[model samples]
Target: MASLSHLNQQLLSTNTLPFTPLNSTPSISPPTIGFRSKSFGRPIVASADVSRRVVYVHAVTSDDEWGPDRDVPYAGVAVAVEEKPVETETDKLKKALVDSFYGTDRGLKASSETRAEIVELISQLEAKNPTPAPTDALTLLNGKWILVYTSFAGLFPLLSSGTLPLVKVEEISQTIDSEAFTVQNSVRFAGPLTTTSISTNAKFEVRSPKRVQIKFDEGIIGTPQLTDSLEIPENVEFLGQRIDLTPFKGILTSVQNTASSVVRTISNQPPLKFPISNNKAQSWLLTTYLDEELRISRGDGGGVFVLIKEGSSLLTNQRN
Candidate 1:
């Protein structure tokens, strides 16, 4: 018998019915009970505010079923990686020159492109590292240098064509003393039946750090016929004696940068020329390139000599 309006208000205040506008339909939901403490058989209900509070929770999956489609938020700032510096022109040139010398093929030919490249590199290097004259220059030349390239007109044809019958050069040493210098060259040549060894000695003077004068003094030629199994020929007796062969004299003039030079010398006397002739000295520019272990000198007439240090290998060791 309670009023209908009063009953409706009671239902709405208790949350049993949802409030709506006058023209809208009323919404109904299941009844919610507040959590209460239990003592023996009786129940003590909690406050109405506690029952009205709503909570939401999100669950995270432990499996990888949603891994590909999951949206992951980055927790760190982005960073960039750095790169190495580029090589300089000088470094590239140096590498190219070294490759030309110690590369697969042993020697650089006079007319080849590699030789031209070497010449260009030498010029650039000399310009960058200009060496002073006299003291500094002579000190630099003190060490033993293996000849890696040479172009002396006299010896090139014989070495290239293998017509001189020379088997190998045992040793070629240039020793500079305080007052004088000596050049000793030992060579082994193949004879008709056996091999003969010959040693040539030359004395020189360092006129200045940039200039040198060389004079051929004596030659110790071995007797190949004596060692041969065949009967000795009467005409071969000259090989036994230490012949006072004709002396070869020449002057080498180096440039200020210590990179190239010019040589004025009489043509070397032929091996058979006894009582050597005093031929007029000829002048030619010699383009010289040197590092710690190798020495390359090219003559204007297209002769090349490749010499290496006494104990060094052609490939692994090079001048710094």
Candidate 2:
């Protein structure tokens, strides 16, 4: 049994080839039980080594009724056996990824109007606007206790329920005081989350608005974690739309262009933002440096940038 298993493994490891069996012609006389040939041509390259039986033939000839020697064919039949191929890590990973996203309940998209409507609805619920304020962090939430966590528990359900539009989010941790804002770790969201989403666990730090260095504590919350001394901007846009700039630290990632070149930085950062008030509209502002125009597509699919850039301003139709 072990020998057969090893043989099967060897056959499976090799590349595949076609198998054709040749039957005996009607005109050829069958050899007697005692009759045997002295020589066999290359052992007829049988497809299998099973059942080493004895046989006799009057003559062996190349079945060539055609032109060139290269086109000549050898005619004979014996047995055939096949083995299964072994899988590698890369193949497994590929299969896993394909099964995870393709043709599954884990993926979907909204129309432009649908996306805009949903964003507006979320804004209304959060009482915010879709417009982005300047990139200042201090003036907005100077004395708010921004609570941040490192989990995506509630957000994924809100998205899959069709009550929300997926905005490509990029989260960075910074300590904002009455000074300035600094970027810590940045993760660009690629796809919508499956119920079995991956955990974005990493240590990072954000520059406080006042430029004061603040450290994020995993066990502590709501005790004046990081103080921002700078003046917070009235509005802040995130992922090209409006969102609530709260003082909570949690997982920060967007479901936009998964290939955006935002890398992870800052070893001690938290996922939190503290706007002055939750009453005002908050949005996500995506910064770019493309010399040419940066176009954004409607809510078609991933990486669909429908926003057009005219000079220094960006233009997008409210609908369709």
Question: Over the stretch 204-280, how does candidate 2's per-residue lDDT look in tens digits?
Answer: 23332112232322222111111112223445788898756443222222322221222222213453444233322
Candidate 2, poorest ten consecutive residues by summed lDDT: 142-151
RMSD of each: 28.0, 23.7
List the lowest-lDDT window of 10 residues for candidate 1.
257-266
Q: How much is the lDDT of residue 221 in candidate 2?
A: 18
Candidate achieving the largest TM-score: 1
Candidate 1 residue-wise lDDT, 224-257, digit = tens: 4222133322332365865432231111112211
TM-score of 2: 0.16
lDDT of 1: 0.40
**Over 4 Å off in model 2, which ranges?**
1-90, 103-155, 158-320
